[model samples]
Target: MDIPLPTIAVVGLGTMGTGIAEVLARAGREVIGIDISDAAARRAARALEASTARAVGRGRISAAERRAVLARFRTFSDLRAAADAGLVIEVVPESYETKLGVLRALDGIVAPSAVLATGTNALSVTRLAAESARPERVLGLHFFHPAPVMRLVEVVSSVLTSDRAVAAVTALARELGKEPVAVGDRPGFVADGLLFGYLNQAAAMYECGYASREDIDAAMRLGCGLPMGPLALLDLIGVDTARTVLDAMHAASHDRLHAPSPVLRQLVDAGLTGRKAGRGFYTYEAPGSAVPVPDALTPSPAAGAVPGRQVASVGVVGSGTMASGIAEVFAVAGYGVVLTARSPEKAAAARERIAASLARSVDRGRISAGARDATLARIVPAGSADALAEVDLAVEAVAEDLEVKRRLFATLDKVCRPGAVLATTTSSLPVVACARATSRPADVVGMHFFNPAPAMKLVEVVRTVLTCDEAHATVREVAATVRKHPVDCGDRAGFIVNALLFPYLNNAVKMVGEHYATPDDIDAAMKLGGGYPMGPFELLDVVGLDVSLAIERALHREFRDPGLAPAPLLEHLVAAGCLGRKTGRGFREYGRR
Candidate 1:
C-alpha cells in the first residue's frame, strides 16, 4: 500500500521555502506556496521564473516543460491555499514559538490524514509534535539551503510520529530526487550536529587570535579540502541563527563543545548577523550579497612582516614519500637540493621514486620532458647528514616521533653550518623541543606540508618562542618560492588543521557507536548537505585508523577535555588490528594495497 503525496504546500516562502516549492513543482507535483508578506510571495514567484528560464536556456528543460512547472506552482498570502495539500511543510524561522504557531494553525486547514512537518534544524521536533492537534502526523522534514541543489532531506521522526506518515514522506522525498535520511528527534540530527561544533571551534579559535580569520578559513579549505572556510560559512549561515542552533544543542547535551562561542553573541548583538546584514565574520558588498569586500578586520599583505633569510640550496633528510616529495618541490623551484638518507641505496631509491612521479607528470602533459630532466638533475642524493653541511636550509621528514626528531636535530646541529636554517616537518611534536636540541635554538622551525607535498599547496609556517624572526621568515619565503600558500600559527599540538579536524572525527565515531545513525547515512548527510569532499569515515579509512587514533590521543592529552578523548570504539578497533585500508578493515573494509 502506497500513499502518493502529489500535492504539497510549502509555508513561509523565504530562500529555503522557495527552493522547496520550485523542486516540488519541477518534480511534477502541485505546490502551493504560502508567505505572510506579499513581497516575499511575489519574490518567490519571480525567482522561480528566472530559475526555470535559465534551465530552458541551459537545455535542462524544454520551453513547454518550464511553462508546465511554472503552472504547477502557485503562491498565496493565506493558509487557506493549503487546504487541498496532502502534506504541509513549514519553513518559517527557527524559533520554537514561531514554528509551533504555524503547525497548530495548519491543523484545521488540511485533511485529517494530511502530514504536517516542521523544517527547524535546531528546535525539538517532538515538542512541536506534542503541541499539534494531530501528534501522530507531525514530524520534521528538513531540507538543506538551496534545496533544489542539495540532495539531502532529513526525515525526522519523533516518538509520537506515525510510521505511515514517515513512509509516505520518505517515498515522496525519493520521487523529488532527494536522499532522505531518517533521523531521531534531536537538535541538528546528523549533519548540523557535527557541523556546528566544528564551526563553533573555528569561531573560538579566531576570537582567541590563534590565527587570522583568512588564515583559519584558508587552512580548512586547502589543508582539509573543505569547500568553504568556517568563518565565511558562518557568514553565509547567519551568525544569529548559528547561536540559536548552538543554544538548543547545548540545552540538550550540555556539552561545552555545543555551547555557542561568545563571539557569535557579540556579532548578533551588533546587528552584524551575516551576509543578510552585509557584515559578520567578514563584510559583503551589500546586504544579502555574496561578494565579500575588504573590511577593517581583513589583513594587510605587508603589515609588520619581517624580512627572510636568503636560501639558494636546500637539504631534505629522510627517504620516505614526504622526503622525496619535498625534494622534488625544491628541485622544481630551481633550488639546489641535497636529499639524504640512512644509506646510499635508500637515497638513490628515493630519487628514483621522484623520477617516476615526474615521468607520470610528463606523460600527462603537465610538464615538459626537458623540465622533468632538469628537476631530476637538480636533486643530489647522499648517504649521510655530512652532505647537508653547506646547504642554506635543512628540512627533516622522518617518522612522527619526538626522540627521532630530537636526535636528528642534534645531528643537524653539529653537521650543518651555524647560520643554516634547521627545520622539522613534525606534524605534532613541539618545535621548541626540536630547537632546544640545537645550540642555535633560534634556527629551528616547523614547515608542515600535507601528504603528497607537491600537489597540496598549503604549508603551515610554525613559529615557536625560541624560533627567531629570520628562521620563520626564511620558511615562509621558501614556501612561496615553491608556490605554496603559507599560513602562520604558534607551535602547538595539532596546529590549525588538526586541532579542529580531529575533534569532529571523534564525534562522528561517537555518533556511530551510539547507534543513532549508520556510517552510510551520516556520510551521505555530510557529503550532500555540508559539501565535504569526503565523509569522516571515508577519510579515517584512508588515513589509517591507527594514525587517526594516535592523533586523537595527542589532542586529548594536550587539551585534557573529556570530549576530546579518543572514542572507545576507535581505540578498540585499533586494538583489534583493524587499522584501516592497509589492514583491509577499519570503519569500513577496503582491498589491501
Candidate 2:
C-alpha cells in the first residue's frame, strides 16, 4: 500500500537542515524548519529563499514554482509547532547532547507513530536512538551534505528501530529522489566510516611530503578517474569536520586507520579547516569555495627533464592487455608502431586485440572508422625484441616484476640503437635500476599509463638522475602526442599516482579489517559522504587486489614505514584469489551470481 508523503519537520535549520527542508518543500510537501534561536531560524529561511531564487534565476525553476516552495516551507520559533508533522528529521549540529535534546523534545510533542530520523554522519545512531522516548521509531536517515543535490541517503536501522519506521523513511528518501542503501546503526554508518579514514590517510601523506597536492589529486582524478582528489576533497569537506569524524570513528572502532591524522588536527587548530577557513591541505579563495590557490607550502614541481628523441617509429613490447592498449595508443597518435611478443602467433593475436578495442571505440563514436583503419594500418607485429632495433623509442609494458623488467631492459639496451630512448610502463618499479641495465642510463624513463591506456588521461613521466634531458623530453612529447597529461617526477617507486592513491585505499581496507564498518557502508561513505566517484573498496576491486598489494609492497619497502605496510585483510583476499572485478570478488562482489 502506498502511504501519502508525510508532512516533514526538519529540526535545527543549519546548512544540511535548511537544504533538506527546501528539498521537501520543493517537492510539494509542507516543511516546518526549526533552529535553536530566532536569528538562526530567520537565517535558514533566507538561505532557503536565496537558493530557490538562484534556481529561478538560472531558469531551472519558474518564478511561481519558486514562490510555491518558499510559501510551503515554514521556519519555527518553537518546537511544539512541529506536533502536527507526521515525520521529523533532526539535522542539528553533530553534538550528542544537542541531538538528544531535540529527539526528547520531539517525543513529547509528536504522535507515537511519527517517525524520527537523524541526519548524523559519525556519532552512533543506536546511541542516539536509545536517548529518544520512542526508540522503536527513531532511526538514522543520514543525508549527504548539501542535501538538496547529492543522490545518496543512508537508511540506518538502530537496534530498537522498527521495520515500519525503516520502510517509511526509505519511502520518504525515494520521494525526495535519492538512492537509499540500508545499514545497521554504527559509527560513521555507511559513508564517513570509509571516507574519513581514507581522507585522514591522504592528509598524513601530505604531511609526510609523499607527493604534491596537484599530483596527489591528479593521480586519483586521471589515474583512477575519481571525481576529486583526496586532499582537495578534504578541503571541500572541511578539515574540522573531517578531524572530528576521524576522532569519532577511532573512538568507536579503535582502528589505527580511523585515527585522525595529526596534521588534520593541527590544521583545524590553526584555523585552517579547509574551504570553510580558507585553508587546509590547500588554500582556498574563500570560505565554502572549491577553487584553492596553490600555496608556498605546497611542493614545487619535480626538477629536470629529458631531451627529445628524433624517432619516426616506436616499438611497444609485451603481449598482455596493457601492452596491446599501449600499442594502440601509439598507433592512434600517428606513430609507426612495432608491437612485439614471444611468438609470431602471439604477436598477431595482440594486434587483433588492439583492432577489436579500436573497433569498439569507433562504435561508441569516440573514434571514426577511417581513424581506426588508419591506426590499424600503422601497426606491425614482431616476434622478438630484435625487431625494436630500428625504432627510435621502445616502451616496455611487460610484467610488473623487477627481474622480468631488468631482463627486458637488458635486452632492449642491446637491440635498440644507441640514441633510442628507452621507457618502461611500470607503475611501481624504480626506473633507475632499469635504466642502469643499459650503458646509456640517461636514456631510460618511466611512461606509466593507467589501465585502458587509450582512454585514461594521466601519464607519470618518471626521470632518474641518470636519465638524460633528451629521454625525459621524448617521453613528455609522446605523452602529449597520445593526448595524455604528463606530470614529471623522480624515479621513486609508485611514482605519483600509486604513491598517494594506494595507501589511502589500503587504509580503507584496514578500517574494514578492524570492523569499523561493513564493506557496503564503507564504499557508500566515500561516494556519498565525500562526493568521490567511487568508494575506496570499489576502486580496490577495479584495480585488482593483487595489483594494489604489489604497489603497497613497493611503497612500504621504499619508505620502510609500518604505516605503508599492506593490510592483513588485503593479503588474505589476494591469497583467496578474490583479485577484484576481474576475478568476480574483492572487497565487494561483482557480476551476477
Candidate 3:
C-alpha cells in the first residue's frame, strides 16, 4: 500500500523555509506556509512562484505542473491556519529562545499527534524537544541549504522522541526524494560535527599563514576532488553563519577544534558576512551575488629568495605505481625522464604503466594523442642508479621503510652531480632522515605528492633544517614546472595534508565506534553537508584501513596528542584483516564479501 503524503506546515518562510515549502508542495503535499507578517508571507510567496517559474524555464516542470504545484501552497500570517497540519517544520532563525517560543505556540495549537520538526543545523534537538508539551512528537528534520536541490536530510531523534515520530519523518523525507539518515540528537548532528572541525582547521591554516587561501582551497579541490575549497565554501555559506555554527558546536562538545578561528569572527564583525553581504574572503558585485571578484584580503604567494636552477632532465627511482606516476608527471612537462628499477623487467613494466596512464589521459581529453605519445617518448627505462649521473634532479618513490630510503639516497648522492637536488616522496616519514643518508644533506629535500601524481596538483615542498635555500628554491621551481602548486612546510610527520586529513578521518571512525552515527550516515553527512568528494569511511576504505591506522599512529606519536591517536575501531578492523579495499572489508564491505 502506498503511504499517503502528510499535510505539511512550514513556518518562518525565509530562504530555507520557502525552499522547504516549495519542496513539500511539489511532492504533492498540501503545504501551509506561515510567516510572522504580511510582507514576509508575500515575499515568500513571490520567491516560491519565481523558483517554480525557473523550474518551468529549465523544463524541470511543465507550466501546468508549476500551476498545479503552486495550487498546493497556502500562505498565512497566522499560526492557527497550521493547526490542522499533520507535520509542522519550523524554519525560524537559529535562536534557541525563538525556536522554543514557536514550539510552545505550536504545542497549544496543533493536533495532539502532529509531529513538530525543527530545521536546525546546529542547536540541541533534545533541548528544543523539552519546550514542547508533547516531546515524543518532536524531532529534527535538518535539511541542507537549497532544500529542493540538496538530497540529504538528517532525521534527528531526541531521547524523548518516539520511534513512530522518527519513522514518519524519515518516510516523509523519502517521499520528497531525499536520502534521510537517522541521527541521535547532538549539537551539529553528524554533518556539522564532522564538517565544522575541518572548516575551522582550514581557517586556522589561513590565519597562521600555513598557506594562502587560494592554495589551501586549490589543494583540496585539485588534490582531493572536493566540490569547493574550504574558504570559498565558507564564503558561500556566510562567514557569520559559519561562526554561529562553530560557536554552537563548541559550546555543546567543548572540543577546541570547533571554536571559530579569530579571523572568522573578525570578518563577521566587519559585516563581511559572505556572498549575501557582498564581501567575506572574496568580494562580490552585490549582496547575494555568486560571482566573486578579487578582494583586498587576497594573499600573495611567497616569493622564493634564491633563484631556481635549470633542469633539463630528471630521474625517478622504483617500479611502484607512485614512481611510474611521478615519471609521467616529469615527462609530460617535457623533462627527459630516466625511470630506474631493480631489474630490466621491472623498469619495462614501469614504462608500460606510464604509457598506459598517458593513453588514458588522452582518452579523457586531458591531453592530446600527440602529447601522450611525446610524453611517453621522454620517459627512458633504466635499471641502475648510474643512469641518474647527469640528471639535475632525482626523486626516489620507493617503499616507506626508512632504511630502504636511506640506502637509496646514499647511492643517489654518490652518482648524481654535486649540485643536483635529491628529493624523497615520503608522505609520513621524516625528510631529514633521508637527508642524513645523503652525503650532501644541503641538497636533499622532500617533495611529497598526492597519489596518482599525474592527476593531483598539490606538492608539499618540505625543507629540512640542513637544506639550503637554493635547494628549496629549485624544488619549488620544479613543482611549478610540473604544473603543481607548491606549498612550503617544515619536515614534519604527516606534513600538512596527512596531518590534517588523517585526524578528521579518525574522528569519523570514533563517531562510528561510539555509535553516535552509522558509517553510511556519517559518510552521507560529510559528502552532502560538507561538500567533500568522499566520506571519511569511503576514503578510509579506498586508502585501506591499515594505511589510515598507520598514518594516524604516526601523527599521534609525533604530536603526542590523544586526539591524533588511532581509533580503537580502526585498529580492530585492521587486526581483523579488514584492511579496506585491499582486503575487501573495512568500515564497509566490498567485493564478494
Best by TM-score: 1
Across residues 383-500, which tens digit of lDDT does each residue of candidate 2 receive? 9999998999999998888889998999999999988999999888888989888888988989998888878899998888898778888888888888998877777877777776
Q: Residue 40, candidate 3: how far off, in angstroms?
A: 3.8
Tell me how far candidate 2 lies from the true structure as C-alpha RMSD in angstroms.
Answer: 3.9
lDDT of each: 0.93, 0.84, 0.87
Preferred candidate (lDDT higher): 2 or 3 = 3
Q: How displaced is residue 230 in candidate 2, in Å?
A: 1.6
**Highest lDDT among the candidates is held by which one?**
1
lDDT of 3 at 74: 92
Least accurate stretch of 10 residues (summed lDDT) in model 2? 298-307
* Superior candidate under lDDT, 1 versus 3: 1
Candidate 2 segments whose C-alpha is farther than 4 A from its true place: 1-5, 37-39, 51-65, 104-114, 131-134, 294-312, 359-374, 430-433, 439-442, 463-470, 489-496, 499-593
lDDT of 2: 0.84
lDDT of 1 by residue, 94-173 (tens): 88889999999999899998999999999999999998999999999999988999999999999999999999999999
